[model samples]
Target: MAEQLLDVIVRKRELQGDGVVVLDLTRADGAALPLFDAGAHVDIHIAPGLVRQYSLCSDPADASVYRLGVLKDPASRGGSAGVHAHLLEGRQVQISAPRNLFPLAEGATRSILLGGGIGITPMIAMAYALEQRGDAFELHYCGRSRNHSAFLAELGSAPFASKVVTHFDDEHGRLDLAAVLGQGRARVHMYTCGPAGFMDWVIDGARQQGYAEDHIHKEYFQAEVDASGEGFEVVAARSGKTVQVAEGQSILQALTAVGIDIPISCEQGVCGSCLCDVLEGEPDHRDVYLTDDEKAGNDQILVCCSRAKSKKLVLDI
Candidate 1:
């Protein structure tokens, strides 16, 4: 909701790797899009009621176009499937201005970029920016295999190719997390994105290596939490209705089940689409949308992935 929606045209589409499709999008009006830094992402409107957030994979310096890589998962809820099936070149699409939550550390002496599977999207942009600035940086990309890895050719030809390392599970055996992050990484700020388990493993390794939390930047493609039933009550102050948020469900689900419609997207918590005002009670802020300071205030919450820490929550719904 921070940026207005714009129409963009899919200029090109190509297979980046197994089940991954790369889309080259440009303004439908042939105008330059908003400038964005590395690690930025745009909310893509799939259907009237379906929207998803995808990281910008192209170089930030290039304002003429924005590139996104999407993984077409067979088990997904149809976001990527729709893109793969219908979002072909020349198709028109709706998107919001790019927003960045996983930005590089401004003061780090060295930078380490870790990517896994389709998570390489943002890392590619970061690599370009870091290389352009002549910063001390290295990129380590991992995947199940070369066939399933996206953008391998691009990474190999990157300006910082010499600093790029590849680790394919089929060939390299499960990543030697400790060895890759063993030493010297303490001085380098790290930025990583991937599947929940993969990112968690990488983050845990960094923490075990004594990396400062502030220097370890991460973004989750999906929420990784036991959102199971811890029964809680929600007091919808606006509607004057009390609802029981059962276990194994989200706050948003509880509201929607009661016919309380809320604007939401990327239920994973990465996008700030489901943000709501909290009139009372403490919120278990789990979403990546809000900053630490914002979470501390407990005045707002992203209902999609957050829950009530207190027994009852008074929401401005």
Candidate 2:
């Protein structure tokens, strides 16, 4: 992963609103960056062992630079704060190739994009792809206020501006979810990214309105996980080794302590980089990356932020 990282230079930085900042990065050697699809994200190596994932919000057709919209989180674990403080114009940085976890559904006749607050970043790129395909789509952006929303001017000036509807809590009151998603029809798909609570409301609304689970897509930046639990034994079947996972420790930490390495990014369980297969016991799934149906399968686990429910488990390793 280290050898695959691309060195980039920050071309510009723009303040979107109160706590939001947008960054434009280009190849340090004046070459075109790798082409990425809409809803793709790159892992930025902010500092040693400090990697964070951010979605690309720029137009996919243009390979000149990759744009990212970041919110300065007051409760950041150093990702957002570091970017706002040190990721300045002309600064060189390293980032991973783009990876997409929230891809658009193929052959959908209608698409609905719901972006809340800083979540509008990915939706902007998605809008570009949808418009280019000449597909019917609508973007509904909800924010606390106009001053707090990032990329308002850009969204308003976009060619698809007529298809965008914005709702501000301070101005337009609440966005009626029921009205926006009245009935889920065939060939209609929905995508959402934002706070967990807001996402839950939209997802529940969509489900109640007859939308299939596969037709609804979402991406979570972080999840509230309780990784602490009783100690257990993890058997690495391939390596022929066993490690005791102590209480208050994750499976990933325990394995790494014994020199078993698993590539990881976004330790909060959002990136799914450390996903591993389980051959034996049931896992207490705490990550939001896996859907409820996937959790029910119980064949795999996200070792980074998930613990075992069984006392002893066998890993495919």
Give the winner by TM-score: 2
Per-residue CA lDDT of candidate 1, range 129-163, in tens?
Answer: 99888898888998999988889888888778899
Best candidate, lDDT: 2
The global Cα lDDT (0 to 1) of model 1 is 0.87
Question: Which parts of model 1 are misplaced by more than 4 Å?
Answer: 1-3, 184-187, 285-298
Residue-level lDDT tens digits of model 2 in 242-308: 9999988899998999888888877777888899999999998889888898899999999988888
Query: How close is every model to the real structure, measured as TM-score?
Result: 0.92, 0.94
Clashing pairs in 2: none
**Structure candidate 1, residue pairs in collision:** 228-248, 229-247, 229-248
lDDT for 204 in candidate 2 is 97
